[model samples]
Target: MSAHTTASGSTWAPSSRKPPLRARLLRASWRGLPAKRHDIGWEPGLVVPAADGSPLVTDHYFPRAEGDFPTLLVRSPYGRGLPWSPMYGVLFAEQGFHVVLQSCRGTGGSGGTFHLWRNESSDAQATVAWLREQPWFDGKLGTVGPSYLGYVQWALAREAPPELKAMAVQVGLHDPYALFYEDGALRLDNSLAVGAGMTYQHQGTGPFLRAMLRLRRRVRTAVGTRPLRDGYAPALGGGIPWLDEVLAHPDARDAYWQGADPGEAAARRTVPTSLVTGWHDALVDQAFVQYARLRAAGCETALLVGPWDHTSALQQGWPEVFTESLAWLRAHLCADPSGLRPTDVRIHVGGGQGTWRDLDAWPGQPAVTSWFPASGGYLTRQPPTDSAPLASFRYDPADPTPSVGGPLLSGAAGSRDNTALEAREDVLTFTGPPLSEPVEVVGPVSAHLRVHADTGYADVFTRLCDVDPQGRSVNVCDGLGRLRPQDGRTARLTVPMSATAHRFAAGHRIRWQISGGAHPRYAPHPGTDAARVDATEFTPVRLTLHADSALLLPQGAEDGQEVTAAP
Candidate 1:
């Protein structure tokens, strides 16, 4: 082993070295190896220093009678010991690969401060360089993790390190812009939920700390407070400071986001990647964008999307996520072509029985299906040939529309019932009759709206829902688009809803919801379009939705098969 002094004057060990006994055993316990599985030995707190002299904490598990073997690297800000090391580490190590779970800088027992994803690429490269020098490393490294853990892999893959082999990323964020703020709207609930965790984790774990971190309550307070800046910073305790940094730049065009984008990182990735996410995962849109970019870049990639939200994605999926990932990792990392795995894009269709379907390519080049707004509150296949009437609504920001369901991380997330939400006066509903035949809308859905607002600015929220036999409006996918005063005389709004494989059953009705807001799903548009934006106090804006406004669905669309229209 060799050591070199960093600029910060600490001697950096380039190989696994014994950590203090207390540090090694703290919160780390061993479970007996599974019968007939590889008997693995554990080493906790194997400190690897980053280039800047920050100690990065890592735990390693290896087969008892091991020679040099391939390594599975999982880099995360979450603590590296116990739960993850036991759940993932032992499993991978049992499969004949060494598993190393490392806490990112400033997390667990590591040194320096964790600044979300800012330092992951460099820290990961440094770890790999150190891992290569270790006596047991066989020059092959595969990465796995869900959410933030998975994100670190993408960030590091951009470097194209020689030792890096394969990646299995589940429900990870590639585009910070999309993850944080989508189309100039703050993803209030999700952002604050993550911020709350980052805040509590940064502070030392204690009963008081846990009390302070009562994240759900804090997020509720944050959502209720106005102007966002006033609420999020103070409530989150100024730890995990990047929350404010992201809030500072609400748009993707901001230069602050360029470095963290997965689109840019995709161009540099050379490894075979397995992309797993849920139809309702907040970052599902980013997942599709990432898959397309990787394929266009000619990198070997696989995609699996299911009908699940962020938390549920960890466990639920049609083919089972962990097993599919294991098969993928084994195929690429161990060079074992497991024929049990499907080699095409797979998605679980909603509103139907949970059955997995494989497609040679993604849902590409589907026919454009249009649903136009007609008399009363109905969505029809036939366009209005007569004088088009306008539907009007008053948008009161103080009493904004509430979010009931869909792809959110916090506060009523997932496909929850929206029957009560649709009955609100501020919400405009355009419901279609029962489908005579099942319609499979298996790709991106968009809304084209022609609107004129009496106020300077307004926000448009659109949702696709499946109205079941008992009159339950279950959300499928939704999107929000902000209409600024500078837009034009008549705003032509295009809101791109998330992608989904949903089969509208023969008896189910297709419903489209148009609302002024989705509450903290988006920070309620302050009903203003001034040089200085404010959401605390808002004006009542009269918004008119022209009959030209239409909802666009994917291929295999139905025409002239409508019956009842409900207001």
Candidate 2:
């Protein structure tokens, strides 16, 4: 350790002589982080015993001049190197908290096989037990991390000890089933991406990058395989039995997925928790579910939503995320609330000009507005008087509609120009007239449709897009719903288009896109009752949309005025 003098006239020690320069650079990259209060020391390769007496590799980061600071536990399946080491271990430790960055079982040289969510709860309890025995343990603890790390925090909170004072779950996942399946359809791309990541990410960066590239190159072949379960094997660098198991069990009620969801953890704990997520994150809905559960259980919780996808939330949005997280931890653990925000909900509104807005709670009392899809590809505010068909399209499972953009785990995630996607024959679009004034939507978005499908077994994919004056249609938020045999005889269904806080600029058109499936993003419905993984035959389904269908949006104005659609 080397002692360094700060501009504030205090002497602090860096974990290693070389880390100060790297730490300084890392701190510089993130804008507006609170000033470093102490220097940190890193202890690597400490072995913590798991519930089954297995050795779990862990790293401890502590302030050299610490005086009973709260400890922050970050457990991850990803390797404990690069970003994890400097980001969580060094940064938070420098901010006057001890950070225990540990690798979950079978990852980063930890013992035992990784059984996904099955082992997290026991492992978390064991780690805390170990923490209690440490000489420097102050009995005040907090938990923070992103993605899988966030999931571990939830697992720990399920039976959190009194010492666990605060938690910050950023872009986290609580339900493994929800992460892999949506509306009865398997999220093919997400499953493959997660498969590759969990398998190779812990090995090192190089292997993970190579595996991701390999998956990208072979994704089409994998997605188009005759037996869908066997197709992803090649892309994932040989067979991942767990991936196959996940695909085989699409129903969340299956025994295989039982106990996978730790969502009940939120309702059972009253810890001051801060939730962070992006509007376009793959797990945005899960975050909302967590918020709802916490609120329902009367827990102290806060939410921060940005205009970012899953990965970008940590990259581009780190400044805001870090600031919010640090404040929450400080307020709860250090008994300091000076840096906390006045409101519990903060969101970044996306549009021509992106701006941040704060509210007492999320989706607080927004007015529900309806826009009907009329014939001739027009979206109108008035409902149709006649019960006639508005549009029709044929969906071929062999040539499923390609996904353009929205929440996905891979690099191809986020909003994209949808000019080519809209031109596809398998897709139907209804365009609203240009808006004379900006129409802001700030809550849950849903599309209620009355449709008939030639094949009883089908899927309905709905998307909300913003068509700019330049004719660029970029997806805002979208969702998919699986239709059953009973639905073949004209079904009335509501497709949850997730949620969003977006502003349609003046002159921009609101477009509602309907498609049978978004291939790869979702496993294309085989147009039969058989499970997609077992279906060897494919069928084409003809879908007819009724004009009575409407897109429901929770619209709100900044000035408390009514927002009307253009004539």
Best candidate according to TM-score: 2
Clashes per candidate, residues 3 or more apart or on different chains? 0, 0
Q: Which candidate's lDDT is highest?
A: 2
Candidate 1: stretches off by over 4 Å: 1-36, 201-213, 237-240, 317-319, 386-389, 530-535, 556-567
- Report the lDDT tens digits of candidate 1 across residue range 311-340: 777543423666667767878777877632
TM-score of each: 0.88, 0.94
Error of 2 at 64 (Å): 0.9
In candidate 2, which residue ranges exceed 4 Å CA deviation?
1-31, 557-567
